[model samples]
Target: MKAKNGSMVAYDGEMAFKKLSGGGEGIRGMVTRRITGEQMTVMEVKGHGTCWFADRASEINLVGLQGDKLYVESSNFLAADAGLRTGTSFTGARGASQGNGLFTTTVEGHGQVAIMSDGPAVVLRVSAQYPLTVDPGAYVAHQGNLRQSFQSGVTFRTLLGEGGGEAFQIRFEGDGLVYVQPSERNTIAGDV
Candidate 1:
């Protein structure tokens, strides 16, 4: 398994951890998903029976992919099965806010991916008829066939401090599961 460096808390049985590589790409090519060049620390855990990984006591959730792709923020990605392919994809638009990311980590293949959130994350179902709109800060990840689009409700009032916190929303339609953390990520727009 490929996991974040320093994320190993405890493990039972024989295990070996090696610094996979440097320069952003992890052992399985897992990227931090930052085009601005932030180093991603990753390590390969081999011969492990039960390995525990955690980051700041955050809640961990497992997402299963069967020949599908999971789009997740680099901050939420914890670890993934060895066979899963990890990479980065360009997120089309910026939310008129500074904190929403422009690139997201992409995991493909048939395996389970562990994601972490500051709190528990809820899985919402998006169907052809029932679309879902999510605050970008609260979004964790999404999987399956889905169309993602951004809706910015920025107005002059927003600039003058009379607008709601939900000035930006990410709409998702089609068939898929969307992960939303109970708490919002720290974003510049949150103050607005």
Candidate 2:
């Protein structure tokens, strides 16, 4: 399995941890990640009976992917099955607004992935009739076939500090599950 570097705290049986310079995506992926500023320090853990992983005592959520794609931020990523393919993808202005860079992490294949959040994550379902809007800072990860769009309610009123607290949000349509944390991170678009 691949986990965030230094996130392994305890394990039973035998385990070997090796630091991966660039998320174990190979030389080309390393260069691409470096140039895009979507860096992730990862480690490979093998021969583990029971491995415990944590990051700053953050809450963790388990997601099972059956040939689907999961889009998550590197900062919120904890671990994934070794068979899962990890890469980076463009997130456009959503990442810029959250101060998380222009690229997010992608995990695909039939395996389980672990994600972290400031608080317990709430899973919300989105469908053709039930689209959901999420605060960028509260979003953790999402899976299934979903279309994400960045929405900004910033207007002239925002200039005068009278904007809505949630002026920036990510709208999710199609069919999928969205993971959201109750707490919001300090983001550039938090107040407007």
Candidate 3:
């Protein structure tokens, strides 16, 4: 119920647990409930959770996943959970609509899991005013309640360093918190 000295204390149905890893590093939370028969769960965190993030523009970080329906950029990516069926697909690459890497394990609702990144993380509350445009590579973890999609149709001007739109972007539009790493150039499982 309470965590001090950079630790996480979690309670699940009269069962309490603490996170051995300290906070201020990345997404820190606990599993609250498990979905009936899926490879996903509901996670809850104290304070705002974040991923390895940096504004440097060229830094990279390794990362890993622990849930289904994960959205990640092709570049700056290293590896994923061991249980995941590895595959690569571009923004509009053929068969991308299949949604392969998104979900890995089979968990149900109310279940909890952990997502890890290289360093510290930044939690953002997405909304219309400050709509979050996450670089696919920088995405780490998000709530199961959020919606994920792909956005395309960009003009040449946008690709000429215009900043409005470029090649393509994996879009997450909904009312849920997202974890992003500052280092958007690192692969999750690439050689460090």
Candidate 4:
């Protein structure tokens, strides 16, 4: 299993933690991760029987994937089953380098992934019948087949802080589940 460093709380059997590159791609990956502003600090848990993990006091959410890819921010990522594969991909203009990661960590294959959020995450379903739009700040992760498009509501009024408009929104079209947290602050989303 691969988990965020310092997330291990307890274990019942023999386990050893080995630090790994952001996506286990080694030193070059670290350089790329730094240049692209990805936060994927993690450790590998080997020979484990039972293990407990946590992101301090943050809430933990489990997502089950069956031969599907999960798009998630490294900040919210907690852990993943060893059978899963991890990688990074560029998410274009979701946040635009405003402190939110423009690249997200992806987990692929059949397994369960652990994610951390500010509070109990809310799950929203998006399908052909009904598409969903989300504020980037509250966005956490999305699973299944979905199309995301960047939409901007910024206007002259936005600069004056007097317009009834949102600066930006990510529209999800297709079938999928989106995980979001309750927040008043603006955040960013990864690529679909």
**Top TM-score model:** 2
Each prediction's TM-score versus the true structure: 0.89, 0.97, 0.38, 0.89
Worst 10 residues of 3 by lDDT: 30-39
Please list the residue runs of candidate 3 whose C-alpha ends up more than 4 Å from where it truly belongs after superposition: 1-112, 127-131, 158-166, 186-192
Counting clashing residue pairs in each candidate, in order, gives: 0, 0, 43, 2
Candidate numbers, best lDDT first, in rank order: 2, 4, 1, 3
TM-score of 4: 0.89
Consecutive 10-residue window with the lowest summed lDDT within model 4: 183-192
Per-residue lDDT of candidate 3, residues 35-140 (tens digit): 1111121122334333222222333433333444443332222223223432222223311322223332221222222344446567777754555655555566
Residue 35 deviation, candidate 1, in Å?
A: 4.4
Question: How would you encode candidate 4's per-residue C-alpha lDDT over 1-192 as one tens digit per residue?
Answer: 889998999998888999886667677777778888886788999985899998778889999999999998888999999889887778877645224657887899999999988989999999999999887778888988998888877678766866555567888999999998886344332221
Q: Tell me the lDDT of model 3 at 62.
A: 32
Instruction: List where candidate 2 sits over 4 angstroms from the true fold.
Output: none
Q: Score candidate 3 by lDDT.
A: 0.38
User: In terms of TM-score, which candidate is stronger, 1 or 3?
Assistant: 1
Q: What is the lDDT of residue 25 in candidate 3?
A: 18
Ranked by TM-score, the better of candidates 2 and 3 is: 2
- Candidate 2 matches the true fold with a TM-score of 0.97
